[model samples]
Target chain A: MKIFQQSSEFDYSWEEVSTSNWRKYGPWNEKTPHVIAVDTISRTIDPHTGILRTERLITCKQSAPKWVLSILGGQDTSLVYETSYVDPAHKKVTMCAMNITWSDVLSVRETCVYQPSSSAPDAKTNFVQRAEITALCGGWQKIKNSIEQFTVERFQQNAAKGKEGFEMVLEMSRKVFAEQREMLRLQQESKILQEARI
Target chain B: MSASLAPECNQVKEQYDNCFLKWYSEKFLRGTATSDECESLFKQYEQCLSKALKARGIDSMLREAREDNRENDAEHMRPKP
Candidate 1:
């Protein structure tokens, strides 16, 4: 088994960061352009705590080496199942994801957490991500080692691109949010002016 | 907005996503949401998506994954800092 971990900070509030997560995989992200679709499978809110839970499936185009592709029957796409929990009261978001395609040969499980920075709770968000990759190929220790090494290298590269893409999406979400707020302010001002004339 | 995995479900999925986004930012995050407002749209999208999942033989795998991960589910509503 191979493990990978990453920690970083987003220069935005936790609310902003979490909200942007929903829009992270669109065309705005050129760095991680392999994402093709994201489908919400289920969603529910805990009535008592107001915490929201969502299940989603993400489809992405795979780019494995020719040999690996051949081993997997030349499949070109992979599916990932992800589950997320948003605790508004605690101001934290946690997501867990696992690959569904080719699970018999390789297993990749990942977890991510987003919370307010401990030092600057109001202004910054802390992001932590971890992944565990295991080669399920039995009786072929050499093949397993090679597959693990290759996957780790690819995982590292993808992680970097994923962070870059997420930042772009965050910026886009912030702009849209700001525009909506501005529009609401203008409508309120117009309403006040009309009331004054009456 | 992200597209649904199945092309046939895209329209209904979009409707549900828009509704959920509004509720998430304006109500759910703000502690003002009283009830879910997108359930019907979600059901509509689910119908289409389930067919796609079944066709691709992913539905059973999804069910198994969910069960395996149940024990590792995130702890909810931790004390605020």
Candidate 2:
């Protein structure tokens, strides 16, 4: 089993960051072209905590290494099942994802937590992500090691791209939200002026 | 917006997503949401998606995955406050 962990901060409030997370794979993000489809399978709100829980399936298409593909019969598309909890009262979001495809041979499970940064609680959000990778090759110890190494490298590269893509989405949505707010303000002003004339 | 796994479910999925987002930002986050506003739309979209998943034989895989992780469910997975 191989473990990977990373921590980062986004210069945005918790609300803004969490909102942008839903739009991470919007059309504007060029970095995540491999993601083909995303489906929300189930969603429910806890009556007690008012926390929202969501289950989603994300399908991604990526070409594996030639050797790995040869060993595993040429499957290029992968499916990931992800569950997330949004605790509005506590201002935190936790997401857990695991690969549903090829789990018998190689399994990757990831968890992410998003919360307010202690240093700049109102202005910045902190993100912590951890992934566990396990490869079972049925007595092929050498093959298992190779697979783990390769997957770790690939995961690292993808994580970097994912962060970059999310930042772009965040910036784009911020501008759109600002514009909408301004439009609403103008509409209210016009309504007031019309009322005065009447 | 992201596309649904099934092309036929895309339209309904988009509608549901829009409703959910509005409720999430305006009501849920504010602790004022009385009920889920997108439940019906989600059901419609899920029906369409279920057909696709079954057709692709992915439903079983999803079920197994969810079951295997039942012990480590999201409620117990949150980080310490």
Candidate 3:
């Protein structure tokens, strides 16, 4: 099943957006509580290409509706072992492979691209996310269909949550930047004061 | 939804993460990418994360993936003659 295929734009540069997305973790919404945790098992950087390879253990809480859960027959939390290739030069992160066990069984390959928005006058990043979901139904067509349907619905929910979470991360990044700038300004001011006294 | 695999690393990881985010947005993306303010914190966090991954038996998998990545890198870098 092809779960999510969407493009969205953010008010940040492609590099900023890509970096934030690469390190994302935690709950997207407080009320519904779809939590995501990522543990980086290993990270390697290729000296020649500057590409980063990251192996991550991604645990995601499936807060699917009761009906969907009933159809899927899986644990509340899904564990995915994913290998991601992060190409900073191209502003792209590709989940080249992912193995999901202990839930609505599936294997996922996804890619996300961050680029300048052609339509927007202001500098903005256009994010394109695409995923291919294959159900591990062990040859049962009925089960496969159920799993596929559940995945499509889940992807929809996740896509909305992802946008919200991205915005929050961007806001946090802005705040951090402002705080750093303020600190540098104060340090400069103090240095000038000390120089005058000297 | 995701918490750090190593709860012990969370503190340093959060600190390093905040620093990295600020640096990435303000410095790296803005063309001043040669800063090392968060280097120490990142190293500390990585140490903790490494221990956690070992505890969870994920280190082996990571090693295998890294090897594969290295092979792929080598293949890509090979001279085309």
Which rank order by lDDT, best down to worst? 2, 1, 3
Q: Candidate 1's error at B23, in angstroms?
A: 0.5
User: What lDDT does each candidate get?
Assistant: 0.86, 0.86, 0.63
True contacts kept of each: 0.60, 0.60, 0.48
Write down the TM-score of model 3's second chain: 0.76
For model 3, what is the alpha-carbon lDDT of residue B76? 37
On residues A1-198, what C-alpha lDDT tens digit does candidate 2 reach at each position?
888899999999998899888868768677988888889999988776667888899999967879987665577788999988898888989889999888888889999999999999999999999999999668688888888888888888889989999999888888999998887777677977456653
Share of the reference A-B contacts seen in candidate 3: 0.48
- Root-mean-square deviation of each candidate, in angstroms? 3.2, 2.8, 5.2
Candidate 1: residue pairs that collide: none
Q: Stretches of candidate 2 above 4 Å error?
A: A191-198, B74-81
lDDT of 1 at B22: 86
For residues A1-198, what per-residue lDDT tens digits would candidate 3 score against the true structure?
A: 666689888998666666667555544334234545666555555665555566667766766678656655646675566666655565555554454443235655555656667886246888788877777657678878777777777777777776787787766766766797787777677978557653
Candidate 1 residues A1-198, lDDT tens each?
999999999999998888888878877777887888999988988766667888899998999899777655577889898989899988889898998888888889999999999989999999999999998977688888888888888989999999999999888888988897787777677977456653
- Model 3 stretches astray by more than 4 angstroms: A26-32, A64-76, A91-97, A120-122, A186-198, B15-47, B54-81
* Greater-lDDT candidate between 1 and 3: 1
Selected candidate, larger lDDT, 2 vs 3: 2
DockQ of each: 0.59, 0.59, 0.37
Worst 10 residues of 3 chain A by lDDT: A26-35
